[model samples]
Target: MPEFTMSEKIYREEVHFTGRVQGVGFRYATLQVAKEFEVTGEVKNLPDGRVYLCAEGAEREVVAFREELEDRMSPFIRESEIKSDFRPSSYKSFEITR
Candidate 1:
C-alpha cells in the first residue's frame, strides 16, 4: 500500500459585507456558521454598517466557509468585498467581537 499524506496551504481572508448586515442577526448567524467549519477568527459589526469577517484556515475550508456564509446570509448582504493573503494563524477559536 502506498502511503498518502494530505497537506494544504493555510490562508486568511478579510471580508466586508455591507447592506442590512447589522441589526439582522448577521453576527450571530456568522458565529453559527463558523462553528460548523474548521476556521478561526472573528466577526464583528463595523460602525459604518458593514460586517467585518476575518477568518483563517486551510484554503479550501476557508473558501467553503465563505461560500456557505454568503449563501446563508445572502438576503442581508447587498455588497461584499473579499481580500485574501497567506497569514500565520493566530486565533484559537472563532468569535464575535464587539
Candidate 2:
C-alpha cells in the first residue's frame, strides 16, 4: 500500500439540527465527531432545543461531519440544515458551549 496525503482546505460552516437534540447527548456526540475530524468550533443547544454548531476544518472533514450527523446520527436528530462558507479561524479544537 502506498501512503498518500491530500491537502486540506479549511472552511467555516454552521449546522442547525432540529428535534431531540437536547437531553440526548447530541452535543457531546457532536464534540466527539468534531474531534475525529480535527474540526474546531463549538456546539450548543438553542433555547428552542435545536442544536447549533459552528465548525471550521478541511472540506472533506466538514462533509464527513455532516454525513455522520445525517446518517449514523440521524436517528437522534429529526432534521438538519447546513450552511457553509469560506472563513478562517485560529481555534484549535471544538467545544461544547455553555
Candidate 3:
C-alpha cells in the first residue's frame, strides 16, 4: 500500500479585485469561502477600489480558495488580479482586516 503525503509548500495569494467590490459584501463572501476550505489569512478592502487578501494554507486548499473567489463569489466581482506565492507561515484563523 502507498501512503499519502501532504505538500510541504504553503500557498499564499493576494487578490486585487476591481469593479463594484465594495458595498457589496465582497469581504464577507471572501471570508465564507476561506472558511469553507479551512484557509487562514486576512482580507481587507484597499483604498484603490480593490480587495486584498493574504492567505496561507495547504497548497491545494489555497488554490481552491482562489478558484472559489473567481467562480463563486458575489456578483459584484468584475475582474480579479491574483498573485500567488509559496512560503511558510503559522496562520491559525481567517480574518477580515480593517
Q: Cα RMSDs of all predictions?
A: 6.3, 7.4, 6.0
Error of 3 at 89 (Å): 0.9
Which candidate tops lDDT?
1
lDDT per residue as tens, model 1, 32-96: 99999999999999999899999999889899999999999999989889999874567889999
TM-score of 1: 0.89
TM-score of 2: 0.82
lDDT of 2 by residue, 1-98 (tens): 54433333358788999887799888888887876786788999999879998888877787888787667677778878889876546467789987
| C-alpha TM-scores of all predictions | 0.89, 0.82, 0.81
lDDT of each: 0.89, 0.79, 0.80
Query: Could you tell which candidate, 1 or 2, scores higher by TM-score?
Result: 1
Root mean square deviation (Cα) for candidate 3: 6.0
The reply for model 3, stretches above 4 Å from the true place, is 1-9
Of candidate 3, the 10-residue stretch with the lowest lDDT total is: 1-10
- Whichever of 1 and 3 has more lDDT, that candidate is 1
Candidates ranked, most accurate by lDDT first: 1, 3, 2
For candidate 2, which ten residues in a row score worst on lDDT? 1-10
lDDT of 3 by residue, 1-98 (tens): 44434465577887788888888888888898887896899889998888888888877888888788878764777887888877666567998989
**What is the Å distance of residue 74 in model 1 from its true position?**
0.4
Off by over 4 Å in 2: 1-9
